[model samples]
Target: MKMDLKSKLLHAVLGAFFAAASPVFAQETPNVVFILADNVGFGDMGPYGGGELRGMPTPITDQLAREGLTLTQFLVEPSCTPSRAALMTGQYSIRNGLSLFIIPGTPNTLPKTAFTMGQLFKDAGYSTAIYGKWHLGIDAQSLPSAHGFDTFYGIPPNTSWDSAATVPGVMLSHSAGDVPEKDLIDKGPWIMEQKAGGELKKVKPFTLEERAKIDVDLTQKSVAFIKEQAAAKKPFFLYLPFSMGHSPNLPSKDFAGKSRIGEYGDKIMEGDHHVGQVFDALKEAGVDDNTIVVFASDNGPTGLEFSNWSALGAPDMGSSGPFRGRLGAGTEGSIRTFAFIRWPGHVKPNTDSYAMFSIMDFLPTFAAILGKELPKDRPIDGVDQTKVLTGESEAGARETLLSFIGADLVAARWKQWRIYFKDEVRTGSGHLQLGGADTGFIDRAYPSVYNIEMDPHEDVNVGGNFIWAMEPALKAVMEYEATLKDHPNPKPANVTNFGGN
Candidate 1:
């Protein structure tokens, strides 16, 4: 066979073109933007029934539901740090070694080796930036930059809202703000090094004014980052975990009194406005149609002072729709919160799905989108719900979900049944019980079981009569608990009395 050199070269070029175009020819890559609201209730939006939002109304949130898919059965851990940890690792908080609320000085932190959503997306060729709250850990090693984000702007923890006398972590700001020295003071049992320009420096305490300004500056930085990424013509994964609705309900002057429900409601409205700004920025950059926007809360509303004001008159302000219990409890209200996804053309407009999904599902779902494989050796608690979100599947993606309260496995939501291992009303700052004596681990004498589909409020306890029927589900929970001890990651520092205030 005698082939000419020119002909051979032409064939080689054609082959190279086909090989490079294979992926694009098979799939379309979409930019992803995940927006996480802090302590915003399930019913705090117009679509979910929060009454009038801002001044005019919350048309932006409702517009998302009308134009995309709304997840009615989405769930997350009861608190901020645990929820964020589960979300990033695609595993239960216990498995990731972040089982409790990560206090400022807690020795426990998310290990760098663990996989995060940002890491996965970045490996898959997406530019990742995390704006807003990063409550997982405050150390530079635990910052978003180290966790695979190309750019990081925002407060390390929402605990910055706590008085200077209370919290021990520092607030890192990218703009001008007065940071309290105490805020930067790390009374930690762990050591941290800060990296700026290629040099490492030891961080010290700062002020609340500095921390507060950091949040505001981060919003501006986020807007700028999105614009820059869009200009570069690259796919981006922007994880905006806002701190507006969490605590110290400090709404900007413009948003104050915008809502009739007091400071908490005003803060929520402020969060909504920031969300709208992000969307607007995307539109301005001409990436709105190609970006997948997800809006959800880390957990339910906090029963703090400001939030209580809304509870007094506006029941809808912090309502978890038909769910019971608030934040920090094993009840549905604590775990089940607002979740909305908007992807133009791919998802059905104004469509809503009641399929059960969890925050841990984000990593797997994003993996599915990027055609990335999950770690085979590690057990991933999240299921691939990409089809469910894209309107390709109507059935629930997960059959059961294990909810952990600190190190304890307190609740399990399987099918329509939700089993609460103990009865304890979460009060005070910590997600701890209110009464004097501690209600030890499992009050096996009387576990509460509710067919959530029928009694979403969890008012009726069916455990006594349906004990035999729930045996199989209970056995499943026990089996799952046993697997936790064998998790490949090392156990985190035990947090025995961290939450009880």
Candidate 2:
């Protein structure tokens, strides 16, 4: 399915012709390109808070926000796998068995039973592909192609961390483009997957220096896929979950020293460059006006009052803007992520929406755009926001959102009030100020609460006065628990179905 240079150009021309004729034959369904950044902070971009402080050049992301609506209250799960699972299935990860961390070479696949957003769009005749991180599962049944994507590539589990995959004497300088075919190998711990949920077809015994440029390779592949699909006269659903700003923050040689804050900032700048490339590709394909491009993070930043890594100490981890806490703490900073949506001619440009929108809402919202009803067999935690997205309405409400550290519901945001059922306190683990939290410290007597409308940072605690506010939230959780009891997640563990292959 990989296209060569000439083939890509030919397909691009054909696709353009078909697109031009599309207006006469049928009303075109919008193509969707969802970009999810790994461990990006709430204030990492120019539109967010990092623009003024951090010297990372994020003009593309900022321009995208200016050309569309920037959502201030968009939320997601505090971790990678859980956020992705909720995003794809429109259900909480706790019910889906992906609430915990996903280890490599382990049984951490999402269930085949759960109908995903990819399947929904693919079933509707959209050409679907996912290039980049697919952390849902490493197994065949749990891979991206199995979950409704027609083509899938890139790292299955995750990239190698500095603590694990460092090597010496590797070449460090190269153009941010495709590597030579002769350098490809099929043996290495960090093998880049090629087939759709298939075995490792390509790998290389590359040094850590070479591996650092994976984000660039992913971007090239993604743009090529977009062009190929466009040539085929088919609309596409491209889910590009970038592996940047994660641990072992490695920027490509082309982007080295591009940022003022060093390696992590360089990676962010490089990531924004890739975003610009994608946007440019859309425009080149003549589908810029019709394409629905959504940019957001899987979770919050990697630093702050939570788990601290080397990148954080480089003082390079993104800021959480005005929020507090970091990833995996069930705080506002952990769940509140940057969200921007752009659709030309439909959604108003340069507008801001404070509507509480969850990443889970995407599936139902997309379904609404297709004028199709969601399947009635199961419960969906997402609400349709067609009006909210199209600029027809300024007001929207998710009303309640549950934040979890693992299987435990640590915090619940009910409208303006957020109640913390469990206290997450950071403890020094011999790493000085760099520490991890001692989770599950439930305070039954005086659980801390915050009015999010007044104090978005969660600094002031008014648990006693807002104790009554938890009444309706607790009832809602009770009702949700009842539904889960009825339609329990079948694979509340990994999707371990390997048929002797």
Candidate 3:
């Protein structure tokens, strides 16, 4: 084993060359932690506008913004299930029969054929898991575990934060003689868990009291997952959808009276605390530098008139920043929200991108990063935005995004111009209200166009003066329609069966 200096130097050079060329010697893939906030608004967090003003000081979120890239014109669908469907499938929710929020026992369910973000990561040699809401469906075939997530925890299928509000009192008034309280409780929602290739199992009853503390449990479980993956030295993808921003915004015991505003503010502050905890966990596990942390909202805020649960205190729902309309309407406020990405070394810090980014873009963008090929059989609306994220280009890949409510395309955004094909009006009292419901749409003789950058509130319609804008806007619509010839969307869920077929 005694080698001369010349022989030793030659061996070292050969070893270095092999290490540089071999796939086995490549660097580890980056891990992704995506935290999805439910109905959190553009002006709700500190960096956007409303931190101290709204009595919710989000120091953690502000720090994250400073440490990474902030997306100013980030857009999403108007409601939960549709937005979530877009996020998961990299396409318009209408393509998957989930363009509206899915109600229990309804015909709308996630189609089995639709490919998901989880499956993409799973195929890329990353350990994937989703904790929190799984509103896609309650069916065994449609659960997160079935769709390529290695683990699933939190709310049961098709249920949301309000599922915990059915208590034995004034609101949930059942016929005492006909329906027993015990029987109702047994049939109520519970915190569920499942692993890949396993059946979903209930962990505990998700009562109103449990709802206040569910986000805490979710944070704990997510932290554990992070630590476990770090120890194994495995690349992982964690999707944590927090329940804080949704109405009945009850905070945990520690953050109960922390905010000067009402229950919603308290919950917002609690969300900040949870964000800090996850960041700390990543740092402690020594995976902070290699992990990509993303924070974003599912949609705009819920209105005071809809699902106003003042159980613990006043539900100061949310503010839509400078925009006017709330969750449902096809207005700027309804679709525009906040998004932050902190990819330590890859993304420049304290930078802002005004480029229009869609929630659906995550899937294709992630696919590009992981070197995965997308399925060629289906049409993917999302474009690869790796260049934008890495600062290679200022203008993003997408220029036009079509906004749909259920099966109908209500609006379309092209560059800074928003063209509305239908006028939206909020329904009066005595009308049945849902998240993206209670808003009647009337067909317009000519599409109304608003330069969103100039008219942030959409106050002035320049459709008459800038009638030429209709050509490009309508062209975007026409191009999407042309795709229907080859790849028609699954039949509308309401008219068809539950599977969206």
Candidate 4:
């Protein structure tokens, strides 16, 4: 009953073609729960090799991996905002003018024109809600409610964790009477919420203490949403973007000091517990076998190399597994992280795929699976990855992904080759700043190349011998440029620079 590689590829291609041509059959639609962990490295979880080895036990997530397919080559944008934009829009973040992280009060925001996954599910008759971390924008047009979610809750609208540290960090940095301390601390960024077609409202000040315990509230809301949807027998889409492992890694009081590794370890352990709670809710609702669960990190961790660990009183920060560099840098570890997909009977359990899957591919893949059509008005970077996810194709539907850091195409991955356009070295501080680092880019005489399959660490450059590989990588770049000629991107949002087109 087993088909050979050629036959499988042919069948997959034909099946995709026929499915697209035929009218959507009245098949069972599975509920979707996508859990996006921020700043989690590949080696941080039990399944990918962290867990107890790193003094953090993640038995719950480990079991999730065992019951589904784990991706070894899942790729994402270099940082949080870009990765999340790509996930929601099915386009490169640059296309949406969101290539950089949106700083508080900056002009940057998710454009009102972009189509999102929340809208996609809502149009398909699924109840949709997003809990925890909507870093897209603070304005009404950019919030989750505008994009199609029925409800959204978590951190302040349009700000990062730095907003939580504002009470002392901002209040103390400035002279007294420059701004009232009470107003600065008390009226600072608060936990915010919004319902569809409703105004975004503040709930409570997002203090350092609240930040430590925010994940618990997010998890509780998600469980309630799932239960509510199940009671109504409606297909639902739940996007749980956890605020764990980002920075100032604070675990709840219950999990504090429970891990051997420090605050960072405790946070991951806490995240594991919350993931288990969501899974249990699905089972208790009797939707366990009829739902698709995707657990993935937006990007890699912030290793001690980028931050001052000694000052934070933590022996370690985060692990990039076997790769080099951390979250902000242009390296394999920065973009390549963990992703697991579980759909009970649909996805084969305990399998691993080395397919080149990008975060942008989710929208189109979900559309295809749900028998919905993607908008034809704009260029969608994501390809249909249904065949890959359904075990019909071992080789995924995509081979190339371009990585950008504020309009600059820093790197490109084609097949097993990772090609770098510039040489970037970390400059001691500014790792959490706008551009990801206080580094300078050196103009390389020739592009650096690494065969990722052979050299996972990117220790050696084989570009001289494989100069021909750069042809395909550059071709991908040229093709993207060609698209910009007719359908140009909006000027990218940059506070420091004014030279984007």
Candidate 5:
């Protein structure tokens, strides 16, 4: 059947429209480098508030804040594994079935069916590499290679420098069985083979003094990877999750005593130094302008051994700024964190945005950058905030965020109000009062309300007289919880009970 003149013209017009739009889409692809810092606090950086620790003002991190957009209301899960999982999948930890840190040698792991950011980039013809901690899962099936990373050069699980089998005070991995330390050393490819029971088995022949040198060597390798990828003209996605400032608080000898606040401060400075190396690598490769660099923490400070309360004559080393509570608690202090992004010529410089964002949004945001669409069947709790990052929009992409404290969903942030399903815990070293006793758990039935816009510190709880006013926000939270129940539980494993027997 021959088309009439009107029909033929219509087809020609449609063809031209698609042709014009195709090039615009092709030219929009940009390289992404997501830098995740472990256990970093909101006010830990020099740009934020660390002048007391570093004299004469260290300006490397401060420069990023000056030249990029700072996310004032960014948040993450309370711990490393859940936050990492959320960032990688663009879904909540509960949705992905990885709500807790994956126990070594357990059946629980990030399921192979779920898609990750690395996989998304790899599918789009981008080279992806992760060079740091992979604490989400340690099983063979959950390895970085299987999760869409083209190459991985970091610890497969949470192994540290203190393990006896490794070089004195250097991170190491051992084979996955009861192999002798001597046998592990004999078996080559030293870093990949780790003992099964989370022990570092074979020590490299490096002397005790040489352990600090290993960190430098890792930094060099990471820089080399960036250089190589740039030379090949490949747009790369590098996930650098550093282990510094987490535990054992070890920095190189040169950096030790560099801060007035002791080891904790020294480690913070060292982490900034390593971040500078990554920036230098990008600049050296001539890809700094085109690459989008995002720096954020996995969660709040651990403060177990290096509590600021004890070290600096303060209550905690890492401050959550004006937010209340600390790591592991449901307060803003635990979830709210530092997030900064640099994309030269794209993002506005030295600007602070109050747009509510989260680690859960990274995957979707990256997908938006690459012009990829998420699967419709997979319900993503995160929205593409590329507009907010690029200064095209000012409004927060999310109206509400669900927060999980331990095993239960305890609170939700909606607009200016944060509605807690449980009793709000007191901030800083105070015993949580539940049932007239000192119970550690933040009670959930009382439903405290805080106007975050006015009182970020959460000093006053207005839930008493405003129950009627808070009904809408509280109802929204319940509806969200119900939606999760209707869907298949992403993680089906039993919640491990670690209470004293």
Candidate 6:
């Protein structure tokens, strides 16, 4: 039948509607908000174990576990910079010549040639902003702004370097008015400012009152950034790496005395509240739907037994939860961490995945989400885990993971079994022993093996039962080493020697 004039016009209008809006509606880019906690232990939160914050219940992270997908076997490097490198570049820290935190006097920096997550998202048409600790590097070219972020406002190096005692002239000009505030607070707050391609400048001499407020300030900045992008109807990536739970654990005044466990518990509780605020901001800005929120700790807890925190003036390192080792060790307790993804409508709520997951997996996973290809010229240790992250498939691409201490391949995890080539125990001394392979060398006639699935703490050496688990791990190392022979680790600047950058 022949259509009348009105019917024909309506059909034409409808066709134009879908044509104009289909791309935006069908595959609109999802915004990403990555929240990272520093050196949080396994049993620190409610879902894992320490959610009560020593009986003070961190409702925020607990609620997130209730609403989002928690990866029970999430893993990261035992330390900071390496974990950051893997999360950003999908490669081991050694591959980028970054096996340790960028010390203040050291000239270490991640090579300029490395591609990063920030660059990837920005290249894919997302506005990227980082508002928190950036320990990767503080050199001329190592700033976050240089690596695909549109804005970089956070601490560089770390508290160890940023303190007034370490950096000369760190304390800003102050008077009696700032003294009372200073008395209440400790340490100075030094903020960094940088444009996408501009110079890196540290805003010196911010008040001591400022240190106590930095976490809150960073949280607000992150929320504002998300709101601004949401209002502009643009996809964005906000990386908020918290600087809490580290030594001299300083929680804001609001959370200072809120926890029963002391400084560390207070800091964790503060972090939990910040997380809740971030999620709240997403909902308030009307971008809750179609947004992917990932929450995880940088690594495991600090020290093996933190019960001495009371006299040491350190925060509660929390329990190892189900694991045995702590930070600084190559044990599961130190490497395996808490992780979750909240992608509305895409990921099922309250889903707990036992599949092996790694911070390195995010690069390829986000690449897949944006329909972009992973870099082909360089080696990418990260496997695409979009299917697992989105809950579409319970099986993920990661089947094995390598645990390291500088150049030492201390432990290797293959499925449920683990093999330890070298003895790695997390102690104050052990962490200090990092930076070389010979530090913790333990030449055992027979390697130690454990079934992680059956013994989460890695207490039972089931090598006799799973005797075959050792070859695959050693084979994995051999195969990886073989590739490096031809690739020859270019060994970027500043891994060890100062002024090397």
Ranking by lDDT: 4, 3, 6, 2, 1, 5
lDDT of 5: 0.69
Alpha carbon lDDT of each predicted model: 0.71, 0.75, 0.86, 0.86, 0.69, 0.76
**Candidate 4 — which pairs collide?**
none
> Each prediction's TM-score against the native?
0.81, 0.85, 0.93, 0.91, 0.80, 0.86
* Candidate 4 error regions (>4 Å): 1-27, 175-180, 305-312, 428-436, 498-501
> By summed lDDT, which 10 consecutive residues of candidate 4 come out lowest?
431-440
Cα misplacement distance, residue 236 of candidate 2 (Å): 0.4
- How does residue 157 of candidate 3 score in lDDT? 75
- Across residues 340-457, which tens digit of lDDT does each residue of candidate 3 receive? 9999778999988988899999999999888888899988999999888888889899889999886679999989899999888656555344324557778988889999778888
lDDT tens digits, residues 1-501, model 4? 999999999999999998886633333588999999988998898888999999999998889889999998889888888899999999999999888878886888998888999999999999999999889998878999989899999886577654677777766677545877678866778898888988888899899889889999999999999999999989999999987778877789999988987888898999999999999999999888889999999998876553443225674467889887667677898899999999977799998898999999999999998989999888899999887888999998988889888768888999999999999865555544322344456768789999987998899999998999999999999999999987899877576765443
Candidate 2 lDDT over 178-280, as tens digits, reads 5543342222445455554556455544445555787887888889988888888798999998777776677888988788887778888888899999998
Candidate 6, 189: how far from true, in Å? 8.0
Ranking by TM-score: 3, 4, 6, 2, 1, 5
> lDDT of candidate 4 vs native?
0.86
Question: How many clashes show up per model?
Answer: 15, 2, 0, 0, 12, 8
Candidate 6 lDDT (Cα, 0 to 1):
0.76
In model 6, the clashing pairs are 43-50, 44-50, 45-51, 46-51, 52-57, 108-494, 172-205, 264-315
What lDDT score goes with residue 106 in model 1? 69
Q: State in Å the error of residue 299, model 5.
A: 1.1
